[model samples]
Target: MAADDNENWEDRPLIMPFCGQSCWLVYQTLERALGRSVIIEPGLSWTLVRRQDPNMEHLAKITKCNTMVVLAEKLIEESFDPIVDRHTRNNMIQSVVYNCGSNFPRTNFSRFYTAILENDGRVISAASLRIPSPEIAEIPFIATSEAWRRKGMCRKLLEAIESALGDIGIKRIVIPSSTEMLAKWQIKFGFVNVDYQTNKNIKELNTLMFLKTTRLQKVINPITRKTADLNFLPPSSPRLPPAPPSGQ
Candidate 1:
């Protein structure tokens, strides 16, 4: 997606910058094009999960020989790349997107997203997804690490994911629900039972379809320059409803 001066970012990154075709390409565009995280609220910030090295140990645990403070060169400043060009910024942006296949949602799922609220400096919240076809995508979970339940963070996370999905031209999303939460998923979240077309695609879905889980899906409105303008309105500032019973 092209970056222009007139871009409205009130519900951004969540609304997805440069949202267009290809889910994987959408991920790449967000990292390189947007390259910034949104502070969702006073205390919460939204970002892709940070990627960490598998072999590295704790900072204090590293021996002086492999340490930072007393390193041979001026290591602290050396650690940061000089932002000389697009290459420098692009590399920096990639570090924020998590890539651990071993994590929740697992390796088979292609993309991982998170809704993080930093407290005293730490990141958290999560989701994982797989794109079975250009028109259909499957999501495994959305969760937060802190006691942020009922605070609308999950909605914000879903908005962000939906923004990207709609941007990439993915027409619908499928999520699995337990029988217990089916009502919440259907009524509260606006999901409905799978129809014939989605069910027809099941053979191609493989293990992406969870066993015994109630299937839920929501049709996405295709986002474009026109419709995207309304993408990320906050809860307090929703689009007005129609006037009713005017002559009753």
Candidate 2:
């Protein structure tokens, strides 16, 4: 969490335009350390919005602005290094709105989770995901500014996201991928192609996935961060007394 941003988050249900929610400030020891406030300023961070937050209109207003599409845009494209020096509301970690990609527009933006990196105040790299079901989480999009690519921005965000999700009791993560990038995603991200049958077994997957996209999955245990194959097969039924003893 940004040091300056932390000092101002009042002890109330404050609206965090950057984080896209009106949740209470996380001030306690174990809780704040375990939640989304784990990341820091000038680097990796995440913004979350749940299903029925009170600040939905505020979120829509900020996200609609094309202002801070990169680095950090605080309503007017300026990076306030020392937020305490400024008069804006206290937000734990400030990040401008960035929602894009194939499946992003289709899903309810109110439920998206974002990981972003900013420089000065502009968002240089970012990615997003949604929790359609407890069985799996889907990363619909990830992008880095052309100038910021290849510097490991997305990788850092990805790791942070996996850890955050694991802390929330979500153990599996998925991404909708293209055929050409399947092998590369597997090698670089520890993901495997979720076969068509397995995909169907996870019913909620079909709800949010785009057509013509390949599904890939990875299991990050938060503690172990281990890799595993897809496992949605139905339990096998016991044989019925050897077919009634050959028809008696």
Candidate 3:
């Protein structure tokens, strides 16, 4: 969400999904107090992509970059906070409240995984999952420091995130890319472009991509009563099961 001061955001409202109801209410209250126009800015458009294959676990094992991938939940469990400053510097909180609300400890809904170089113990790359609904998870941020780019850190973090989600029965993931090259690069990792549109406010094209994991398939049974197969349907389709009842 951070941009150069010279760039104009067209005075649009910022649209970000919170990980918990409390954070959502807090943001809403803040917006009401400060006015939506002051809080939201429209500048960059991002492409959305998804992946569901646990087989992608191999990508998480890349050792050529001399870094190790670990779940942020584990770090929190051990009381690690050195990387908090790094996340702050990157403006991670402006995009989503991953560090607040129900995600404070570690829940299946909002989890952050990171990559760190062994030699210096410095975090090089990271990605977070925000489950807006039981049926969908969004990766709002997947960042690698400039010094770590082109070293497979981002890919490692991505693979780790997908593998972790698959382990817990998450079958869908959504990613937003800011550039065509980034969207194209994601295709190699199993994402497919499903929609494209031009954002008049940002003056950029936004591509939406998705992937259905093969691990868990909904099998509807007439007698047994099971969920229907509405994978290809839109999220709001009536046939799809209602979102998880939990606020998180």
- Give a tens-digit lDDT track for model 3, residues 1-248: 11224323344345223433333332232222210011011321111111212335544323322122333333222332223323234323322323332433222222222222221344444454453333334554456666667866565555544443343334556565545445444565555443322122112211112232111111112233222121223322344332223332
Could you give candidate 1's per-residue lDDT for residues 191-248 as a string of tens digits?
A: 8998987776755454243445788898886542222211332212223222122121
What's the C-alpha lDDT at position 97 in model 2? 31
All models: lDDT? 0.46, 0.46, 0.34
C-alpha TM-score for every candidate: 0.52, 0.52, 0.36
- Which ten contiguous residues of candidate 1 have the minimum total lDDT? 68-77
Ranked candidates, highest TM-score first: 1, 2, 3
Q: Write candidate 2's Cα lDDT for 118-232 as tens digits.
A: 5554566655565544446677666667677778766666776676556544657888776776887899878987767557655533434544568788886656652211111
Candidate 1 lDDT = 0.46
lDDT for position 213 in model 2: 69
